[model samples]
Structures are given as C-alpha cells and as structure tokens.
Target chain A: MDTIDNLADNQPKLVGHDHVAQINPLLPLRKWLYSWLFDPGIPGNHQKAVDRWISILIVANLFALLFEHVDVIYEANKHWFHWFDIFSVAIFTVEYLVRLYLAPEDREFGGKKFPRLRYISSPFAVIDFLAVAPFFLQAVIAVDLRFLRSLRLLRILKLFRVLIPACRQFVKVNAGRTFRQKVHALVFAGEYGGTLHNIFDMFIALWVVVSVVAVVLESVQTVHYVLNLQFVILDAVAVAVFTVEYCMRIYSCVEEPGFQRAVLGRFKQARTPSVVIDFLAILPFFLEVFLHHLFDLRFLRVFRLARLLKLTRYTSATSTLTRVIVREWPVISAAAFVMLLLVVLTASLGYLFEHEAQPDKFENIPQSIYWAVVTLASVGYGDISPITPAGRAMTIILALLGIGIFAIPAALFSAAFSDELTKEREKLKRDLYEMLADGVISPDEAAIINREARRLHLRQNEVDHMIEKARNDRESVADLSGLPIHRIAAKPEHAIEHYKALLGQIRQLGILTDGLQFEQLARQADRLTSSELALWRQIHGNHQSQP
Target chain B: MTDTPEQSGVPLALAPALTLADMSFLVFLAAILMAVVWLGRIAYLEGVKTEVTKASGEAWVQWFTEASPKRFTPGFEPSSCAGGASPAGTNGKSAGSDAGASVNPVPERLWEGCLESLMKDVEPIAGLRNPFSGKPLMFAAKCDTDDRSLVGAMVLEKLTPTPPGSAVAYTTSSLVGADIIERKLQLRVTVCDKGAYPIRIAEVEF
Candidate 1:
C-alpha cells in the first residue's frame, strides 16, 4: 500500500485537478455540461439518456421525411409538423452552441480573441446554422415557397458527425499495424516531404475551386456569358497548378530520397492495393491536363471518382475492401478481362449481322457496338434491334453472356466475404484466449466473446474450448486446492486414493517438490482431468455438475 | 441483280380486281399496327438491356444514350416512286375527288366531296384549264332514273402527254334527288406513260 501510494505521488497528472483548476470557472461548468451531454462513457443512466435523445432525433427526422410526402397530414395538422421541426431545430441548435462554448480554446478560431467569430467558424456550428438558417432566411428574404422547406433535409449531414465515434472504434479494430507505422514515418519525413505533400494538396484544393467557378459561370443566365471561355480558363488553371505540384514533388524527391528511391520506397511501403489506386488518381489528372485535348479531358472525371479510394486511408471498411480486392485480384482480373473480351466479340458480331438488314438500327459499326454493349450488359434499352432472324439469335446469345459477366463479380465478392468472416472469427478466438489466460473467464469477457462469436456466425463451443485450453496452459503453475471443480464425486474413493499416492510418489522423485512447483503440477493434473471430463460429457450428453 | 420486273414481261398494272380504295385502307391499318409493334419491341429490349447493363457495372445514363440509336430497325423505303402533282383539275373538279373515291369513304372525305359539289354547282360559269395538262374543260352532268343512285356531275378536260408522264383532268357531277341517300359514283380517265406502264382508270368518285 505504501509502495502504491509512492508510485501514485510520483506519477504526473496531465489532465487531473491542476488542469481542471486552470480552467475558468465558467468554462469548466460549460465543459462539464458538454461532456455530460455528449460523452459516451458516462455512467449508465446518463449514457442511456444520451442514446434515447439521439434515437429520438433520428426517428423525428425519419418521420419528417415520411410526413413531408403526405400533403393531407400537413393540411389536417399543420401545427404538428411545424412544431416537430422547431423542436428538432431547437435541440440541435442548443447542442451546437454548447459544443462551441466548450471547445478547447487553442482549437477555437483566433484562440481567445474573437470568440463569436470562432464559434461561428466551426464546421458543426456551420451545420447548425445551415439547419436553422434557411427557415429564418426564408422569412427575412421574403421567399414564401412551401417546397423550399425541403432544404432542411441538409440536416442529414449532421448524422455523419454522430457516426464518427462508432467509425473511430471500427477503424481502430480493422487498420493493420503497417498502415499506422507508415503514417508515423511519413509524418517524420521532414520539411521536403511536408512541402511536397502540401503542394499536391494545394493543387487538389485549387482544382476544386476552379471546377466550382467554371460550373457557376456556365450556369449564369446572361447572354454575355461564354461557356467556352470558362472551360478554357478552367483547363489552363488546372493544368498550370497540377504541373507545378507534380514538378515540385518530382524535384524534392531528387535530393535526399532520390527520385527513383522516393518513388520506389513509397510504392513499396504503400498497402498493396493503395499503390494502384494512388497511381490511378494522379495519372488521369496528369494525362488529361498536360497531354490531352479538351474532348478527351472529360473522360478524366471517371478517374476523379477513383480518387475517392484515397479515403481508404481514413475509412477502415474501404481499406478492408481494398485488401480483399487485392487478395483476390487474380481471379477478379481474369473474370473482368474475359467479360470485356466477350462484350467486344458480341458487339462486333451484332454490328455485322444487323447492319445490312436494319441500316437505321445498326447504321454503322459503332452503333451496333452500342446495342451489343447494352445487350451484353443486360440493359436492353429496346431503342435499336436486329430486324433479321440471325441478328435476333445473336442478341439472345449476347444476353446470356451478360448474365455470366454479371455473376463474376458477385462470385468474387462472396468468396472474399467468407474469407473476411473467417479472419474475424479467428481474431475473436485470439481475443477470447487472451481474456481467459488467468484460468477463468469473467462474465463480462464471456458475454463479449459470445456476442462476437454470434456476430461472426462461429460455433460458441469451439470458442469455449479454445479459451479453456488457453486458461489451462496459462495456469499450469497455480495451486489446485482453491480451484473450482464440480465433479469431485465422479472419481471413486479407491481411484482418488490411488491418485493421491501417485502424486506423493511424484513429489518424492524430486521432480515437483517445491510448493509452487507442486501447485503447478496439481493445476496441470486438474486441467487434464477437467478437459477429459468435458470431452466425456460432450460425447455422453448426460454429464452434469457433481459437487 | 438480273431479276428485274421489266425483264419478266408481266405488265405492272394499276388496275386490280379489288379497288385501290380497299388496298389503301388495308395498307394504312397494316402500317399503324407495324409501327406499334416496332415501338413496343424496341422498348422491351431496351428495358432488359438497361437492367442488365446496370447489373454489369455500366452507368445507366451512359448505357441508355449509347444504346438508343441502335435499338430500332431502319425505316423501309416505298417500293415505287411517283412524282407529286396538284390535287386539283380544270372545270373545278379536283384530283382529290378521284383519289378519295379510291380510298375508304370516311365521313371527313364524304363531307369534303359534298362541299366541292356545292361549290361547283353554284359557280358553274367559272372554269379554268388543268394546270399540269393544260386542257380546256367544261362541266358534265348525268342522271339516269333507271338506277336509284344520285350521282354528282363530272367535267372532262383534254389530256396532255409529257416526256416522262401524262396528266388528265376529269370531273363527275351526279344529282342526288333524295333527302337521305348513300351513293357511289365512278369516273375513269386514262393517260399515256413514258417509262412505266400506261396510266389506267384504277378508281374514281363523283
């Protein structure tokens, strides 16, 4: 107790009483309230209160979506709908304000100086503002359209913020150590790395800005607006910014890391699937902006969506999907290529067969190709067709090919899904083993294992057996007398006496003489006996507790 | 390639045992049903392809736009071509009178004929030459009590033959003495032909 007290006195209290004392009285009260409201780890009752409120808010929004479609409901009880909206808006606004009030000072905009501006600038605060602003803005701005109230649907984004804590737990469980280690190393790669990263990041930001500006200019109603000029300007700016960023990234790597070294190292270090994704993200932008014509530029937008794969770095599920895709790439790629070949062949045949008889339908090779593509993919738009009998037969064949092509991806996913489930089960088994290492499973730990096993669709008996084995192996040195046993009378008196005599003989042989050693041996013997009894009970289906 | 209608030595005649009116009506009905079936087939095929393409990872919009132009059979051209001519003739008798009589006499056509008959009978003094054939014409009137049918009068103008085709102007006026009556009137006018067969009196109306 004295030693424990000494250790406690020596330990640094980074966020203990001193930190609480440092906080202004008013600020501390606000922080306490915020934690009370939002903190998930609050003692049982308050946590339940928070969960109930969140559920109520979710249910309210869902009800609003449903009710918004029912004009009669609104007409019959107009006040009810308005009141629901007002209540939700009020609760969200208060929560947003409390968060702003309790935000750490350093994180607030302008630190301590411009508190109001700081509060307004936060993202959640902006969400709160947007959620309620449209209603009042409608009143002040004299916009009277009832349908405009639907913009309140933007409040759905706030649900994403609510999901963040759950996503954090999911991410911690799924991300491999290699990813964490690489991120740590990259962070420490110093000024050059930082500058290069910043340049690429800035380029992306600038591209987004230019794209938005172009969209706005294109949408303008004025006769003087020139869409071609906006497109040209957007193209030029994107090219210029991307070129600079790429050049800087290339140049910086040339010094310490060496260009090839940096590139190879980064490639080698990247989690296998991300390397391909990273290449795809940058390649399209580089090709379109620096090397291609405007007509070809639009195709790059497809690759821009691929840039979303970079979110794998932040999203565990996406990363796990990427890993699964990589592991099964050979099969997937083979299937994909086969499907592509089939599409091309079918389209070519369709064009040939349908061209002469149905000139309008298969006017040219490309037109027939389109029909073949749709047919093979099973879209069958029915706009064009083969008027000839042979052409119809070919279409039938193409439709069958489409089914096969569609099934390939599904099969690949099923295989990968099962593999993932198996891996999760094994991980649960390991966790159960660790928890049961002290020779007994706590009720809480057992409950968690049961829940996880059920979630993974694993047999509970298998998990229990693994845990018992681990426990017995870990407690091989423990005293046996205090150990819980239910089957003391299962062994006859003569057998018990014989076993006791054997144990004495073993001790006399100097193999297990010390008390700790004797205890370990006894525990091992107890584990062996219990395991045998467990197996016997399992087989017989009639064994019960004897103690 | 050698299977030409001209080489077959069978004259291509405008005359048939069945009147041109019956043939035209049948053709019109057939055309409408064909169009509906064509559209329906295309729509069904397109719907199936759309669902299949979506399942195969193709974007719905891209697949739809790309497939639309290729989804239909080409429109068939008419087997025979004829030059356009004005539907009116000299002596206030219109070519539409003959063509209308050849087709089904729907209510609209009968009403138009009635209006034309009234105009001609009221203004019999006003006459003009047939614009294509350049033939002078006068009104013709015929009513026989032996047949209880009321027939409108028709005027016949001269026929002028051209290098490629010939044009003729004709009119029929039949008197309808009864308050309520259904009547059939027929007029026949023939013209010389250059490349194709000679024009025959296929069918006509008063």
Candidate 2:
C-alpha cells in the first residue's frame, strides 16, 4: 500500500518539456501527456494515430502469441519471437508507465493524496499492470508452463476495455436522449430521421453476414489449421461487436413501445423473439469462457451461427416469414403433428412387415424411424429399403402421403407470406397518404413516412416510389387542388383559400368588377338597399333561387 | 516412451504446480493487464484513433489456448471425489482415537485449507512429493468416516518432468467409506507411474 501511494505521488510532473514553467517543469509535461493520451478534444490527429498504432500492436502481439504455441513455428522463429516479445513488452511497459504517471489527471482520480494509487487499484489500472507484469516476471522468475499460458490468455480480456466506450458515446445523445429512447430508435425501425442510427444498424447487419461466413468457412480442417489465428481474430472481433450491441439494446430497451417502465421494459424486451436471438448470439461466447472445461466447447462454438438470426430484424422478408409462420402456426403445427404420426405409423408398419424378412435391418422401432424420416422427408438415402411386398406397398403409400403432408405447411406459409406482403405494402401506402394529407411535403412529414417505410423494411427507392405515388394521387384529386374554383373546402385554412380562388375566377369571367364586389353584395344582401339589389340582379341572369 | 506400452491418444501436457509465491505473481500480472486495458479504453473513448484497429487482441489469446496441443481434458475434481485429503498418518488406532475426540452425529470440519491444483496421494518420484506434504517426506494415514465416497487422501496432481514412457493417470474418483471409523481402514499404498500429473508421476492410495 505504501509503495502504491508513493507510485501515485509520482505522476508525471513533466508534460510539455519545452514550454515548462521555470517553477515547475512537471505540470506542463503532465498536462501535455494527459491531452495526448486521455483527452479526445485534441484537434490534432497525432494522438488518434498513436491509439491506432497501439491497437495494431496489440493485434500483432496476439498473432505473435498465437503462432508462438505451434511447435514448428516456435522452433523456426525462436529469436524473432524473443525479440518481438521484448519490443512488444517494452512498448506496453512504456505505455503502462505513462498511464500510471497521468492517472491523477483523471477527474475522479484527482484531489487525493494518492490519486495514482487509486488509479492503479482501479480495474483498468490492474489490467495495465498485469499486461506488462508477465513479461517482467518471465525474465526473472520461472513460471509453470500452464500458468504462463493462462497469463497469456489474459490478453484477450483487453477487449472489454477497448470496446466499452466506443459504443458509450452513442448512448449519450444530446441532453434529452434517454438510453431507452436511443435503444428504441436503434433497435426498432421507426425513427424520426436518424441516419446514424440506421447506418449503425446496417453495419451490424454487415458484420453479422461476415461473422456467419467466417464461422462457416472455419469448418474446413485445412482452413481451421492454417488460418486458425485469423479465425480466432474474426471470432473475437465478432464477439466484441456483438457484446456491445447486446448491451446497447438492453440499456435503452425501455424506450420500446410496450417496455415503458424502467426495469420491466428491459425485461420484456429480453423475452422478445428478436431480442432472444441477439442474446443467444453472444451467450455461447460467454458460456465457453465460464464453463469451458465442463462441456465440449468446440461443439458449443457452432452456436455462433445463430448470429444469422439477428438479420431477421433488418429484412422484411425474414420478419415476414416469421409473421406468416406465427399467423399460420395452427395449420403448420397440425401438419407437423400429422407428419410425426405418419413417421411413427410407418416405422411400426415397417417393423411388422420387414421384421420377418430383414430382422437385422429392422432391429428395433427406433432404428426403423431413421428409414421413416428418410422416406418422409424424401431424402431417400437408399441406405435402407423394404424387401417384403407388404413393406414395399406400405412404402409407396407413405411416400405418396408424405408429399401432400409436407406441402401443407409449405403451402400454408406461401399463402400467408403473400397475404403479409400485400398487407405491408398497403400499410406503407396508407402511411404515405397520411403524410400527404395537406398535399404539401414538409421535412418532418417526409421523415415520418420514411420511418414507417423503414419499419416495414422498405428500401429507400421503394419508399421514394411510394411517396411519389401518394403525391400523384393527391394531385389527381380535384379536392386536393383549386384551378380557379376546383378545390373542396376540406379544411378551415383551405376554405378561405378556396373562396378567394372562386371569387377570382368569377371576376375573371368579366361579370363582377372584382372579388370585393362579390363579397360585398353577398354580405349586404339581407339588408341590401335598392342599388345593391339592382347590381345583384344584373350579375345573376340565370339564377333560379331568389334568396 | 520406453517403459510403458505406446499409447495411441494425445499426450497429456504439464500443468505446473503453482506455489503461494507463483499465485501471488499471477495476481500481480492480472492486475497490470486490467490497468493497461482500462487506460487503453479511456484513450479510445476519449477520441483516440483506436477505433480504426478493429481487433481487440482477444482472438489471438483465445486461439493460443484453444489451438494448443497441451489442452486440459477432464482430469479430476477433488470436491466430488474426496471430502478432504491429508496423508495417511501412523495407524487405524490413532485415527480411531481422533474420531473418539469428536462427539456428534453430523459431520465435522476436521481441518480446512486450500488444496493445491495438482497433487498426488503420495510422491511416486524419488526426490519429489506432494508440496502440501512438506516435500521430501511422505506419509499415509487413515481417516474416521462413514461416508463411502470420502477419500482419505488422493493423488490430485502429476509430477514435474513427467516420465515420458509412463501413461499419465489423473484421479477419477478417490473416496473413503463413511462408516469406517478409526480402526476400520488402513493406508493402502499404490506405487504408480504415468498417473498423476506434473507434481508426482505415481500415487500411494490409503
């Protein structure tokens, strides 16, 4: 503790060495270092570049560590590995030392006698210490190889530190943005024009594709062995991005429509289908870390493929399919149950008929189910077949029934999908018409239409087309416009405009002198003197109603 | 490789027995790692160009462990196998006397200390032994118990510089009978090779 306090007291007093004050050279240097390392307000790109360099160095060190384990690679590049380790460790050491020196510069960390000590004891500070300690220890002390390896694995934990804040600023939108509101805007489709939110979502979709592809390609044994490090890097990057996304969604889920209350909103979102997919996507990564030894983690990694499920939120087609299935669940489920019944019935029948002929093949009911699945799914692996006449007849009957039985669900889904597509398009059209009610487009009005279109997973071009159609429809209606006196007095504000236009047209007919002439006679007709009645009679040659 | 029949399976890797000093050192290393990562995060969040570098260095470390040939398999769980392990002492008479000292129906906490990661029931190698046994000396004693699954002592770890020719056998289950009181059971020594890992190559079972 005393050593830590002394270390804390020794924060870099020297920041800007050249501009150092005569009384205290350390203060300027400390300020300079703090800005260079911690302050994002720096206009210069140099500090930012330095951060990139560190990240690159970290990745490079990871590659180095990964290959360092392979026997052939280790044997060939022992010296390079050794020197690289030194160089990496030296850089990390310098970084750790500098960070420790400037620890007191952090706001919460300052104002204490041992602010540096407090910083050292903080979570990140401890990581920084451990990051460099291994190298120093390796030189002086002998460590158990396994223990050393675990220490090496500790490098991966650096991810939590790097990514936690990259997405943190996104959460902090201006003054009024609640975490829940941001989540609603980001996770759900309807937005009042948030380009950044949409772009972030697109990037997430892209990553999902890339990660799923990476996971699939990793199945090739040659690829797995030769590019194992690359795969690892990919998985790690995916996990980090996904972890950030999952946390962001949870944090701001309260802004979701149904999830209005603070804690309950998040809980409700947690149980939701799309949100469940998001959770499953990252759960494997964490579970493997916590329970690696208890279960076969190698098999567990295949679960990462579930990241594909996340794309459902971004595409109307998939979400539509989901909705169609949900709407037609009763039919589909009954079809499924019938198919299951067929499988059992067929298996039992095969057992009875083929048992006498091929006892070895039809050994048990469970074994025969494989044949049933093969026949019913129409896969027909030909690995199993019926030898007896009765069995062959049963097979033909089951196969004929299988086609219709399976098609029930497929046909049901197809019909439902078609209906859903029509509904969604109609919904979009309705939203567009609502926005164009006044026959003029405002930016806010346009945004609402766009948000609605986005919620329906409509493309930008599609949205533009739909809005254009709405505008054309509005213009086609005589009620929407007034050519002379064509507009209907649909609204109070439009009513005045409509009357003025009608008077203008009447005056243009060369009958009345002006619009005021028309207005004046109409207002004074009840108590009109003899001259007013004479003017009104002169303008109305064809008028039938005297009043 | 010479003493035993050649095994077809992947060879077991060594997990070095961590002493108190080594554990302290690891804790220090963990601390530094956390601190640097925090500083890096603060730098990145504060608008450092760290975002440009997408990889968080996690994959490399994870792959390093996962892809390694010397991976840990299902070795042993002491809590599940043995109630507590101590070297078998003098005899069943002394063990009975110790049990008589305690008067209770429920089990008692005879002694409790953190068991080391990998230790054997007895040191199989000439110079080495279970570090808990104050190395260079080894013993076997009986325990007072009625629990059938209670193992008096077990070979929890492998010896360092494992004998290449011997097959490494880690403890699967080592238990002491619950009903066995003091004079009921005695130390049964089993000199083994290729069983326990990186600590001692052999075990002496009681």
For each candidate, the alpha-carbon lDDT, in order, equals 0.47, 0.56
The candidate that wins on TM-score is: 2
Q: Which 10 consecutive residues of model 1 chain B have the lowest summed lDDT?
A: B76-85
Q: Single out the weakest 10-residue window by summed lDDT for candidate 2 chain B.
A: B48-57
User: What would the per-residue lDDT of candidate 1 be over residues A36-155, giving only the tens digit for each residue?
Assistant: 555444332243355447545855675575556556446677788778877887787776666666554323442577776777786756866777677667777877555555667767
TM-scores of the candidates are 0.33, 0.45
Q: Is the docking of candidate 2 incorrect, acceptable, medium or high quality?
A: incorrect
- Model 1, runs deviating above 4 Å: A1-307, A322-353, A359-369, A397-405, A438-547, B1-206
Error of 2 at B17 (Å): 50
Tell me the tens digit of each residue's lDDT in model 1 across B4-88: 2233444443322434633554465466445434443443343333223222212212322332343232321110101122122
Going through the candidates in order, their DockQ values are 0.01, 0.02
Chain A TM-score vs. truth, each candidate = 0.41, 0.56
